[model samples]
Target chain A: MSARDDILGSVRRSLRRDRLSDEAQAALQRRIRAHERNIVPQRGSGSGAEIAARFIDEAKSVAVTVQPVASDAEVPDAIVRYLAQHNLPARVAMAPSAALEQIPWASRPTLEVRRGAARPDDQVSVTPAFAGIAETGTLMLTSGAETPTTLNLLPYDHVVVMRTSQIVGSYEDAWDLLRQSRSRADGLIDMPRTVNFITGPSRTGDIEQKILMGAHGPRRLHIVLIEDA
Target chain B: MESTSHRFKENAREGMANPSLQRAMENMRRGFPDKRLAAIGRLPEFDALRDRARDIKNHVLEHLDFYLEAWEAKVTAAGGHVHWCRDAEEARRTVLAICRRLEARTVTKGKSMIAEEIALNPFLEANGIEPIETDLGEYIIQIRNEPPSHIIAPAIHLTQDDIEKSFRASHRQLDPGRPLSEPHQLLDEARSLLRDKFIAADVGITGANFLIAETGSSVIVTNEGNGDLTQTLTKAHIVVTSLEKVVPTLEDAQTILRVLARSATGQDYSVYTTVSTGPRRPEDLDGPGEYHVVLLDNGRSRMLGTEFHDMLRCIRCGACMNHCPVYATVGGHAYGWVYPGPMGAVLTPSLIGVDEAGHLPNASTFCGKCESVCPMRIPLPRMMRHWREREFERHLSPAASRYGLGLWAFLAKRPRLYRLVNGLMARVLGLLGREHGGFRHLPLAGGWTGGRDMPAPEGEGFHQAWARKRRERTRAA
Candidate 1:
């Protein structure tokens, strides 16, 4: 047997010999069955930008800037311009996506774009969202070629770009999408393994429930809702 | 107070007598479960998420060795060291050795359950190293020379008035005449007192919520910025976490985080979720110089390949305790361990051995409120039963109880004998309790009858009454 199979075999054996009552064993099986049933298909459709706007409005209670992208090349220029307009530092963290890298920044001397890695002092980081849930204004970030988890968390400010088609109505719809995607993929559903649903910037009420922004993570969260990108 | 069992009884007695603690517990009993249900009610997919989370945890446990090695590689690549400890003693000794090597005189600590498991504070003090708890709740308990009663709300047992007195006594440098009544005033005093310790401490220790194997990072989510301050401002940063905290990716961590705060305190997300990849990079102006991640096995690894593997899925949300009827009445300290409530009942026995903590499992009313609210869906009652089974197998139970149970089980299995015995007992009880239809005293059942009267059987047993009713119906037809 393969190494994985060997280990699993031993686990199965050990579980069978365990001293649990028959009723307990049956109850556990039932719970597992119920869990399996939840992974089935569901129907939902919504616009990512509308979801993004609603989330940004509800979660942050602040004005948001929605940017539309025509070509991949314009992405970097748009980011640089936005940063420059805000008078932010030149360094920007970009997600590990082919589309993110396609942004032509060779001519922009002032802009220094780096690959997604956590640095203590990076001013702003940009990443693409795997999906966006309109229900709670949550950006569902998954680790893969398109988005790196580090870029979303490390910088002082985080800017997430969501395509309009990737929006879902609720968390259940999100799970259905994930389940379908994993079923289609080969070799045990290599799902990004980690999916982060970010609603707002890092905050703390620890110091006597006094609201403190940017306690340990990012201070500001900016969502760039892209339409027809 | 030698063993946990002894300390547990003492703490329980003290907690039961403390009126303020009783009041606080009553507030918690009403607040937490209601908020959690409301939070869960909003999300139809919460059940699905919990299932997914349980599966994710199971998958991790199944492949823990591979993942741990993978995580170690990532952490080492990111300029972090991962140390594997087999038990609490080893973990404490390793941590102390690290401090001794650095000649660390003062240490600042973020809230860590593993540190409590190892009894790290006392060990540090014995070694002449001063350790300060930075979390407000932990700091209060530290001043009072007590272990945390609750996992999240460590000093929940202490009232504001109690805190005022403790603050006045402890903050000697402050003006003796000033009135310290307000909550904010006490917080400000604590902040000022803890600020210098945060800045001056040589070593900072924390606990990990999730360890990213791919990135070699330790992630912590807290409301108070204390965790970040403790890690960033110190010269050395140490994270003590159980082996099960490792997750494969940040997305997985987020999925867990989504449930964590909602289960913990009804918040969608905690105030701060910090991910520390390594020590400060060369370009960084401020951060820890040396970063260490201590992965403690502490019976957890053995649990990975056992039936208790599901217990590893726990995120330490303490929902089970908040909703548990027994826990709400007695509070966490009554369990007499670092972990308490239903989760504690199962885990303490597993970690400390069933023989030592057999009473913990039996302390529950088995109402199943704990299982229903548990975000991880750990079958807490079933696990408690497992502990009971282990205790029985070892012949650790009292002889009188064992004999009673054995006889009862035998009679229960045989319906004829059970009915005959129960019928006779019921008639006797009815005759004795005709005055009030109840009894205040019963042989070998004083433990139950002591606090409240046992209602006598109304008439014949259910089976006998049913038979008589059927005979009368036949005669009428």
Candidate 2:
């Protein structure tokens, strides 16, 4: 027999042996039914830009800065200008999303755009979040064609350009959105196998309760809140 | 070997004396719970997810026989071996026999609590095969000859200075005067040291976070990626886990994962979530040639048909510990044994017998904080009460305690006599405490007064106070 078939057969035998009494089974089923009915819906209001600004203020980082995306036409230019003002060299990494590509860069000096691999010192990396949760200021990033999970962790400074339309109030709202998006495609929502919820920059207090940033992951996070992008 | 009771007292004394550990614990107490609350607050569906996760665990436990059988079949089909041991001794024997067959000399372990439960390291060493603990925290404790203090953190009690001191004493070829002060330096030193051992070790052993019944796979989640490297590099891979770790499907595992990291370290997920289905396939590269899983029963089967069965739903998240006032003060080692805190208080009694571990149940203040934060929502205090009942049934209570309880029961059964006796005692106690309205010492209450003074009760008890108030109201009306 194949490995899968053998596993299934074993499961059947084990289940028969360990099956609970009829009364207990029925009680458990009722409990599960009650649980499903009482599940709460996620939050509904708040734009991505507003959510980003709130998170930045709450983070209270001395080094990191938060700024609003000027316009859809000038989003890329604004990011470039911010990096230049901070005296950081401009060799930015871009996510393969249409929203990211739509940033008008044809008239500007050729910015080196690399794919697949990332370096530690890379000045800026721009990625579009799948959804932004307004409740706790979390960016929900899922692995897909447009946004690879690697872009978020690879650079020194990360610029998460979240559109106002994609902002949700809670995780449940994000899941609802994801489930709806998945049902449209054949194999989209089988659980991306991985969904990362990044709250803030990487930090540790292992040394005498001294808060040190950039212990392992990115030290600085720059969230560009795009209005109606 | 040091008994868990002895270890508990030793660790408690050390914890009480160590000011640095106290300060560290104080910080952790506020940090973990606050972050968890913030995280849960953001996710409106967190309650729903918790409920779903609990249901999934319950379903798996009810049909555990089926899943275990299925797992065995799949594992066997994939050229892996499965052993079911009814107790710890049997489990130890099975592991030893496997090592003997392979003539294994050295075994490198990847932070397995189950292995500690079986006392695998001492058993291996007694049989002449050296066992090395490869996890950084485990390695430090192994050198110092100390048991792990915490489940997840392990060395949470130790400061960087303590670690440096240990390294200075142990590392033969090291600059004694050099300042060894960075987390990365310590991590790098451990990585270099363990990297060689990982390659040369005859066997690799680990514990499972969840065993997937659908695929006969064992899943391990680790932050350092050490578990992955340990299993992949070794010729043989062995998983030692209790029967309760099994879940029916990958979806169920995912639901559990959603809460697991959040409860443990406030992470969405650990760095690596690995699923190893039996030995490496013929076409696979850099994987173990032989795979084995030992499913330990060890009193767990007996717990299934008892009231304590809900305790099996625990995923070992340590949330109960994080929120526990006693654990926050004394830390994990105080409870003594493989498991600690509220979960440990309930579990140790069953695994080690009520007579040997009866004190654990009574250690709680019944503050209900543990149950409130428990992701599985296992009523921990209630379970501890069940163990206390068992201890009473076994006639394990002290003679004085039994006599006191007997007298109290007699009085309780006869309300008139109880009221008269209590009234007399209250009047006498009230007169004695009239000066200060409290006592520094009380007869037959040494334990209560040993550390602190007890506040004197009011002149009237609740029943008398209530009755007089009612009479006054009726007269006015």
Candidate 3:
């Protein structure tokens, strides 16, 4: 017998059953398909304006800087201002999302914006978030032709562009947004190669329980919020 | 890994006597519990979420076989390979086979207790492949040639000076004269050192926090984004996890994730929660080319429907240990296994054997703190009692304790004789120790009172006092 058969057989014997009955299987399948949310805390729920305020507060608490822009057209200027404020280099590796590309990179001749997955040499990178979870100040980025997972990890400084309308109050709402964004004939879309929920810049408290940032991922995560997307 | 659980008593004694270990453990005693309580205070529905979390795990375990089958199908549909291994040997071989096929020279790893269970690093090194631990804590302990003392924080046992020493010894190229006093200085050193490993690695392996059966995703929750870099930059990504990690859907996974970091590190949510479904899609610009999962069922299949079946509900949050008084004193290495503390006391036996780990169950003081704080609400104290019973049944306990228990059982059956014997002995002891009020030592009970004085039995026995009070109350009425 194969390893799978042997292991499953032992599990069956331990559970004292031949197999799951049709009714049991159907109930489980239905639950999976429905994907019902359970017991989401009311803490994250509020008006959209309240959520946006809470998102900034929570994100700041975790050491992420949030900058608000009046519109998508203003994102490039906000990012450039942030770069200049931090005295960081003007070079950035931008994820190849259509939403991000529409921001005229040529408008800023001083900014060298390379579009693709981040290289080790890149000091900063900007990626468009699929959704923003206000509950924990998390940016949800999905891997695809547009946004590679590498764009979120390799760079030292990460600037995420999230539209104000894309922010959800809770993780459950974030999942809902993911499902609605990509509508197939079926309710579910196969998960992209990776769905990353990055809350704050990378940190570790391993050494004597002292908080230290910039362990392996980005040292600084700056949020460029498009208020009028 | 190799279990020194049989040497628990000696190890615990040495752990208590060591000044450095005691100092480190003091920080944990204050840190974990206080932060968890404060975090719990912020969330009004923390208890309710814990109940829902327990229910989700119970439901999944009841239909584990079916869910495993479903997960396997989804993984295949997503173009990922799933390998089922019945034992640690098979699991190790399965991983090595993947590495050999890809001609991987070096493999970078995220923190995984399952890798420790199979002793995978040594096994891979023996087969001409180098395995690197990427997490800061795991990397610290790996350099020192020590197993992780704590699950969530592997390097908690070490001080900054300890890390500086290890780095100086291991990183010969670096200047040893540089100041490395602060935490950030140490973190910066490790980050620069491991970045090359992440890029040069051929394969990346991580342990799954939860395996989603609905979408075929292996989710990892980490504060550092090293796990993402390890998997994304490599040619192949492998998830080495056990059978019990699977939950029914993304929603169910979220329910447990809600309680996981809050209970462990007192964070609302970890910095990074990444879900990897499979290898990169055809249109994707960057990701691994191959995705493989080796599902090990070493002794977990047998744990289902047993006295310790609830052990599988654990999410490795380390709350049980944080709250356990006995664990607070002795620390993790004393348990001498991949797991430590209250969870280890119950799980070590089931994974290894009762005979090897019998001392762990008996080591507890039955504080019930572990059960009260357990997010899964596993009856940890009840299971420890079961292990003790199993040990007694197998005649594994010492002979003197057995005879003492046998005498107590004899008296317990004869209530009248028990009361007479107890009253006379109490009166005699009360008279004998009238002046001193306590005894420094007593015959046969020397072992119990070795640490401190045993208070002398004073006044009438409990039954006599209760009877007299009852009679007086009845007369007054």
User: Model 3 chain B, poorest ten-residue lDDT window?
Assistant: B445-454
- RMSD over all Cα atoms, model 1: 8.4
Candidate 1 lDDT over B187-215, as tens digits, reads 66776678678768999999989997646
lDDT of 3: 0.90
Candidate 1, residue B321: how far the Cα is off, in Å: 0.2
Among these predictions, the greatest DockQ belongs to: 3
lDDT of 2 at B244: 86
Off by over 4 Å in 1: A1-48, A60-229, B1-3, B6-10, B465-477
Model 3 lDDT at residue A186: 74
Q: lDDT by residue for model 3 over B107-199, one digit each (tens)?
A: 999989998998999999999999999999999999899999888888877778889889889998988798788778889899998999998
Candidate 1 clashing pairs, residues 3+ apart or interchain = A55-A137, A194-B251, A194-B252, A195-B251, A195-B252, A203-B271, B75-B216
After superposing candidate 2 on the true structure, give the runs of residues whose Cα lies further than 4 Å from its correct spot. A1-229, B6-14, B97-105, B472-477
Task: Score candidate 1 by DockQ.
Answer: 0.09
Query: Candidate 1, B444: how far from true, in Å?
Result: 1.5
> Which 10-residue window in model 1 chain B sums to the lowest lDDT?
B1-10
Q: Which candidate number maximizes lDDT?
A: 3
Please, what is the TM-score per model? 0.74, 0.73, 0.98
